[model samples]
Target: MQNRSPSRRTVLTCATAVAAGAAGVVGVTAGPAVAQRRDSRLKNILARMSIEAKIGQLFVPYFYGASATSPSRLDQERNLEELGVRTVAELIAKYHIGGVIYFSGWTNNIHDPHQIAELSNGVQRASLALPTPVPSLISIDQEHGVNVRIGSGATQLPGAMALGAGRSLSDARTAARISGTELAALGIHQNFAPVADVNVNPANPIINIRSFGADPRAVGRMVAAQVTGYQRSGVVACAKHFPGHGDTGEDSHTGLPVITHTREEWERIDAPPFKAAIAAGVDSIMTAHLQVPALDPSNEPATLSPAILRGVLRDELGFDGVIVTDALNMQGVRTKYGDDRVPVLALKAGADQLLFPPDIGVAYNGVLAAVRTGEITEGRLDESVLRVLRLKDKAGLLSGSPYASRREVDRVVGARGHRLTAARIAERTTTLLVNEGGALPLRGRQRRLLVVGASPAFPTDDTRTTVPELARAFDGLGFRTTRLATGREPDSAKIDEAVAAARGRDAVVVTTDNVDAASPQRTLVSRLLATGVPVVHLAVRNPYDIAHLGDVPASLASYCWTEVELHAAARVIAGRVEPCGRLPVPVQRADDPDKVLFRSGHGLSYGTV
Candidate 1:
C-alpha cells in the first residue's frame, strides 16, 4: 500500500511552528562565526523539511530488483518517481537516512563481487540523482573470510574460528583492513562485520564459525583489532547481534530464540565484545532479536527495549553512535509485534534507524503518524536525523562527490591485493586439531588413499565445495585420491564397501561432525576403524565430533569446512603443510563418555618440522 500524501499547501503549513522556532534557536547558536554560519545553514535546511520527510529519512528499507532474488514484476523506480518518491538521496536531503545496509541474498543476480559492486553503485547513483542531491550511507556485509555475500571473484577468507586458531591479533586486523578497503572502493561506506559474539554455546546453529572463539576475552580482543583496522580504512565498522546471539542453539532467522540467562551471566559472558567494540570506537551497533528475559522482563527483545538500547547500550555502555535494528522482517521481530508497530516501538525504544523494514510505506507513515500523535516527538526525529547526517558527513557522502567513478570501483572491488591478503589470513588461520600415531606425511611408497566426507562437493545450492577443494589441493600436491560422499549418514552397504576399499590402502580420511551423532557416518567411521586400517578422521564441523568416533589412530579437527580450511587440511594430511593449527575449542573422546577429551588448544602434532 502507498502512503497518503497531504496537499503541498497543507505540508507547507506548519501545525504549531515549533519546528521553525527550534530551528531558529539552533540557527542563532553562538560559536566560531564560520561554524555558526554552517550550522545556521544546516538548521535552515532542516527547518524547511516537513515532519513526514524527516521521519522518512530515518526509515531505510531494503530494495531488491528481479536480478537480486527475483526481478521486480512492477517497475519500482518508475512507480517511485510517479509517487513523488523521496528516493534514498531525497531522504538524505530531507530527513537524512543514517545509512543503507546491504544483504547479499536480497539481490537477484549478484553472482560475484563485481556484479554486487556494480549493482550497489548503480542504485546509489540513481538515488543520488534526485533533486538536492545527498550522499547515501551505502553499507554492505562484506565480512570477507566467511559470511561473505559477494562471492565470485572476491577472496574467501577463513572463518572466525580460523582466526582464533591463528592466535594473531595482527592477522585479524589485516583481514579487516583489507575487507574495509574493498568495501570502501565499491562505494560502500559501512561494513556490518567482525561479529563480536563470544561463542560459548557449541550447539549455536548460526554463529559457530562466525565468532572468533569461545573465550570472551579472545573474541573481544580480535573484534577490537578488526574495528581499528576497518575505521583506519575509512569504513565505519558495525559489531553486531548485540546482547549476544552466540549462546543460543537455534537460528533467529526462522523463529524467536530465547536466551535463558541471568543478568549476571549476561554481563559476564555476553557483554565483553560489545564493550571492546565500543571502546575501539565502532561507528554502529546492530541489535539482535533474541528474547533475553533477564535484561528486559517485559518480554521485549533487546532490539525494541529502551532499558536495553537506551539504558544499557547508550547510557550504561556510553555508546553514542547509531543504534541500528536488525532486519525488521525477520521472524524474531515480525512474528511478535507485527510490522505496523516496529518503527514506532523501535524508535521509541532508542533505535536510531530501522534496518530493512518489511514495508517502507507502512514504516514511513507509521513513524510519521507516531510523530504527529506525539507517540514520538519531532525532536526525537531531529535527533536521529542529525546523527545520520553527521555520519554521512563523516563517510564523505556529503562532500558533493557522493559517487565513485566506475573505473575506481573496478580498480578496487576484487583487486589482487585483497585476494592475497585473504589468502595470507586463510593460511595463518588454518588450525590443526589432532595428529595421533604420527600417521600424517604418508610414506612415499603408500599410494592408496580414500577420502570421505560431505565437505567435498560441487558448490550447489544445497552444499559448498570445501571437501572437493581440499581433494583437488591434495591432487595438486601429488596424492592419488579417491572421493566418497556419506550423505549426513553413510549407507551401511557404502560403509562396508568403503571399508573393503580401504583394506589395502595406506590410510583412510573420514570427515564428519559429532553434532550429527545419529547419522550413519559415525557408524561408518566405527566400522572402518574395526578394519585396523589407520583412519585419519577429520572433524570438519566441530572438534567435539571426535567424541563420537572413539579412539582412532589419527584425527584432526579443522573446526570449519570452508574451502580454504579444506585446502589447509589437505596440505597437513599430505605432509605438504606443517600442522600449525591448535584446537581453539575443546574436543571430547567417545571412550571416556563422561569425561571431556581434548581441552582447548589440545591438538597432537606429528613433529615441529
Candidate 2:
C-alpha cells in the first residue's frame, strides 16, 4: 500500500516550486485580456504544474489529529486504510492535496485558538515542503451559534436565525467579522457559513435554526452582509447548501431529500440569497446534496448535477468562484454511486473542489485516470485550477508562513469586545411570543424561581456548559433559582419531578425545544401551569415549542440555547431589558403544522414594565 504511482513519488528530488487577488474572485469572463492581467507568478506556477499536480489542486480532504507528524490512532487507521499514510505530512507529500479542513467532530481536530494556530502551522510546514510548494487552504465550519467548531477559548456568537429574529444586518455583519477575525488569527482562511437557506418549513430537521429566516429577500440581505464582513476581515466566506436545503424534512447526511419546486417558485424562494451572495462577490459557494427537481429532472444531487452546478450556478447565477461540494462522503451523494465515481462526477458536474472524499487514493486516481483517457480535458481541469489559484491569492494564502503569533492569539480570539458584541446581538434576539395576563416581567427580582424543562444544549453542541444557563442568569439577578434539567424531550418521571418542584416556587420558567407537541414535555408545561404559579415558558430552540404550549401564562422564544441567549432571556423575564426581537419564521401549529399560530414579526414589548 505504501507504493504509489511514479507521478507521486518520483517528484521527491528537485522541482521548480514557483511561489505565487479579489476582482480575481469574479467569473472567468475574458480569455486573453484576463490572462494578460493574471499574476506572472500564478501563470508560471500553472504553466509548470504537471497533470498530477493540477488535479491535486482540486481536492481538499480532512485528516485527523492536531499534528502533521503524529497521527491519532483513528487517523492512522483511516489514513493507512485510504492512502497508506500514517501522518498528515505523509499524506501531503504523497497526495499533493490542495487544502485541509478542520472539523469539530468525526475525530475532532480543534482544541482552542492557540492549539489551532499550532496545528495550522504544522500543516502548512508539511505542505510547503512538497516539491511544488503551495500553502494549504485551512477551512472550518465555524458558523458560530450552534455550529461553532472551536469552543472554550473562542467567542461563540448567536446563530443565523437569532440574527434574523434580531432583524439587524449590522449585528449580523459584526458577528461574521468577529468570527472571521478570530478564525484568521488561528490561521483558518475560509468559513463555510452564512447558511443562505430561507427556512420555510418547520419540519426541516437540519436547516431550521441554521437558516436566517423564512423570507427570501431578508435572508438574502443577511447573507450579503455576512459575506461583506467576512471578506473585509480577510477570511473567505462560503455561502452554502446551494439551491436551498431549508424546505426539506430529511437530513442529507443520512438520506437524499428531493425538493419539488417549479422553476418560478424556486426563482421566487430559493434563488434570492445565492444571488445576493454572488453579487457580494462571495469567494466560494458550496453545492448541497439535495435534489431540486426544477433545476434537473435527472434526480442527481446538486453536487453531481451539471444542470444544477454548471447550468444554474455557473451559467445562470454567474458564480465562477470555487464551487465546492458538500462532503463527498455523505450518503446522499454516495448511495447510487461508489466513491470512485463520485469525485469524477462532481468535477464534471462543475465542482471546483471535491470536499472530504471517502477515499483520497480512489478519488485522486480516478480523476487522474479520466484525464489520461481523454474523458476529463486538461482545459476543464485548468478552469478549476485557475479559480482555486485565484481564491488562494485573494485569501493571501500564497504568502509565506500562514501562522499566527501564539501570544497574540489569546488576545485576539474571544476578546472582551467580541463577547460583548455576542451578548448584545443575543439580547436583541429575545422575542416575547406569548405574554398572557401580563404574567411576565416577573414582578419582583427577589423571589423563589424554578427554572425547568428541555433545551438539550442548543440541540447539537457537544461543548455546552453543564450549569443550567437560565438558572445561573436568574440567580445572578437576585432570584433564588432552582434548575431542573429535562432531557431534550422530557420523560414522565422528569415531568412529574419538575411539576412537584414548581409547587413552592413563586414563578416557574419552563424552556422547551423541538419535542413533539403531545410529549411528556407538553405535560410538564401543563402541570406547571396547573400549579398556578406564574409560568414563564421559554422556547429555547424553536419558536414552535410555544405553538402547542400556548396555555402557559407567558412564553418567549430565544431561538437558541447558548449562555448569552439564556442570559438575555432571563433579563427580559426580569424586565431588565424590553423584549424587542420579532419571530423570524412563522409559528405553525404543533398539532396541525399547516395552521399558522403566529405570523412572522409577532413579538410583544412591554411599554414601561
Clashing residue pairs in candidate 2, if any?
A: none
* Whole-model lDDT per candidate: 0.67, 0.81
Best by lDDT: 2
RMSD of 1: 7.4
**Which TM-score value belongs to model 2?**
0.92
lDDT tens readout by residue for model 2, 1-609: 011122322233222222223331222233564445555557666776788888888888887777678757887887687667887778888888778888766655776667778788777777767667776788888876677778778887888998999999999989998888888888888888889998998889989989999999999999999998888777889998998998899999999999998999899999999999999889899989988888999989999999999999999998878999999889889978989889999999999988999889899999999999988999999889888877776665654335566766877898999999888888898999878777878887448999887746542355453237788899899889888888666777888888888887898888887757556777888888888788888877887777777577688988778777889889999989899999999988876777889999888988723
- lDDT per residue (tens digit) for residues 1-609 in model 1: 111222333233212222222221111122466445544545554676567556655666655442322245453563254322424333334343435655554334355555555555554544444333344677777665446665655555666777887778898888777777666666677777889887777678878777888788888998998888887776778898898998898888778889898999888888999999998878788899888998888878888889899988999999878888888888888767767798799998988878887666667778877888899988888877766654554554543344445565567766788776665666565555555556676768656677776553422122456555666776777777777666566677888787777777777787885445577777788888888877887777666676676667677766566665677777677766566666666654555544667676765456742
Best by TM-score: 2
Candidate 1: residue 286 Cα off by (Å)? 1.0
